[model samples]
Target: MAQEGKLDLLLKTVEENKKRRVEAKERARVDFVGLKVVVEGRLPQVEKKVSDLGKVLGVLSTKVEQLESTVSRQARAELLPEDIREEHLDASPSLSTPLIRGSV
Candidate 1:
């Protein structure tokens, strides 16, 4: 059609989209407030559960770290030569590929 008609259609579409967006945003805001209220009501319980989980995780992490260290010590004592024990300990992630190749 004419340029003015096309512009008018575009303006109408933009306004309709703006209205829909505003409505969607308001609905989302209401849902968020309701969700916040629900979460807030359960705050103490959630905090307690989170705290317990943290304690369990902390204990697990400590045990894992201790196990790793023990395994590392035993491996060094058994498999590694004495001269390279310290060097190997320091070399574990110290080496890198000399070349960087991208897609062949």
Candidate 2:
């Protein structure tokens, strides 16, 4: 009778564990679905923002190149005599133009 009782208790525990496992699996599946839905819903907006950022990066890159070029020209001009510097500046009007803050 004791052995039978032990067997019954073991069976009951096994069944409870199985039930818990199934419940856990169902919860995980539901959570995954909810996460998928959320990600899918935001994916387009995220992509668009990324694209916009890429455009801004491209613009910023162009401005950096322009600034680098202007700095290079100014450096070269400083190495030259005043008369040549004036002539060089005259040849490239942009080199002499004062940069307004935030204009780029």
Candidate 3:
């Protein structure tokens, strides 16, 4: 009878452990599925943000090119004599004008 009781106790402990393991697995599955859904939902927004950033970078690049061109022209003007600078500007009216938009 004592042997039978011990067997029963061991069986009960085994069943309890099995139940706990199953519960833990189910919780992990639920958490993983929820995280996947959240990440998928945010993917489009993240893509849009990346696209907008590309546009901003393009605009900044164009602005930087314009600034570099202006600085180069100024540096050239400073290097040349005043009479030559005036003659060059008079000969090329377009060089005195600002760059047109979307020309980048």
Candidate 4:
């Protein structure tokens, strides 16, 4: 009868919906697995690049520290009395002649 037909149509619709949901879930799983594989393949390269960057950063840090130390020493020397500055310059092998006072 009419009720039986309605029941059958409803059951058919429910089955179709269930099938669609299952297919969608399977597609999502496949996509996730593909993404996982790609990421796994590239992870090592990413890690290596990060490590290289860290090494570069370390070298840069050391250079900066050395430069800072040199600057600090120069600043301290500049703050000394003119006589002391001349003495230091005379003692340095690099400066064979003392700098004239008040001369650039």
Candidate 5:
């Protein structure tokens, strides 16, 4: 009778442990699903922010390109008159600039 009672108590303990494990596993699963839903809910705003940032970067890139081209054209316009005059003086056979035969 003592052995039978001990066996019943052991079986009851094992059944309780199994039920507790099942409940804990279900709780963990529910928590994981809730976290995933929360993260998914915020994803659209993140995507929108990324898209808006891309558009802003594109506009800035375009503005930089236009500014670069304008500055390049301005620099060339400023330097061209002197360059043309030098070319004319060097190409002429006149006595405007003396030529030294020893300096390459």
Candidate 6:
């Protein structure tokens, strides 16, 4: 009789453990589904943010290109006058006397 009672108690304990395990699995599944839903809901917002940032970067790149072009034109303009003056001087040979040979 004692052995039969012990066997019944062991079976009960086993059953309780199985029930707890099943409950734990169900809770984990529910939590995982909730997490997935939350992440899915936020995905579009994240994508929009990324897209906005890309647009901002593109605008900045265009601005930089424009600035570089302006700078390039300004630099050429600054140096061009000097080059023209030198050319003009070279073209006018009669303005300066030519150096004679063997005369320092």
Per-model TM values vs. the true structure: 0.44, 0.75, 0.62, 0.73, 0.55, 0.56
Candidate 2 to truth, TM: 0.75
**Candidate closest to the true structure, highest TM-score:** 2
Worst 10 residues of 4 by lDDT: 95-104
Tens-place lDDT digits, model 3, residues 23-63 = 99999999999999999999999999999999999999999
Residue-level lDDT tens digits of model 1 in 32-52 = 999999999999998999999
Instruction: Give the poorly placed runs of model 4, Cα more than 4 Å off.
Output: 82-104
lDDT of 6 by residue, 1-104 (tens): 99999999999999999999999999999999999999999999999999999999999999999999999988778877779789788888664444544445
Report the Cα lDDT for candidate 1. 0.90
| Model 3 TM | 0.62
Global lDDT of each candidate: 0.90, 0.92, 0.91, 0.92, 0.92, 0.92
Candidate 4 clash total? 0
Give the CA lDDT, 0 to 100, for residue 59 in model 1: 100
Per-residue error for 35 in candidate 5, Å, reads 1.0
Q: Specify the poorest-scoring 10-residue window by lDDT in model 1.
A: 95-104
For model 4, residues 1-104, the per-residue Cα lDDT tens digits are 99999999999999999999999999999999999999999999999999999999999999999999999999887775987879888887883335545455
Clash list (residue pairs), candidate 5: none
- Model 5 regions lying over 4 Å from their true place: 1-24, 82-104
Model 2 worst lDDT run, 10 consecutive residues: 95-104
C-alpha lDDT of residue 80 in model 3? 53
Candidate 3: worst-modelled 10 consecutive residues by lDDT = 95-104
Q: Weakest 10 consecutive residues, lDDT, candidate 6?
A: 95-104
Candidate 3 vs 6: which has more TM-score: 3
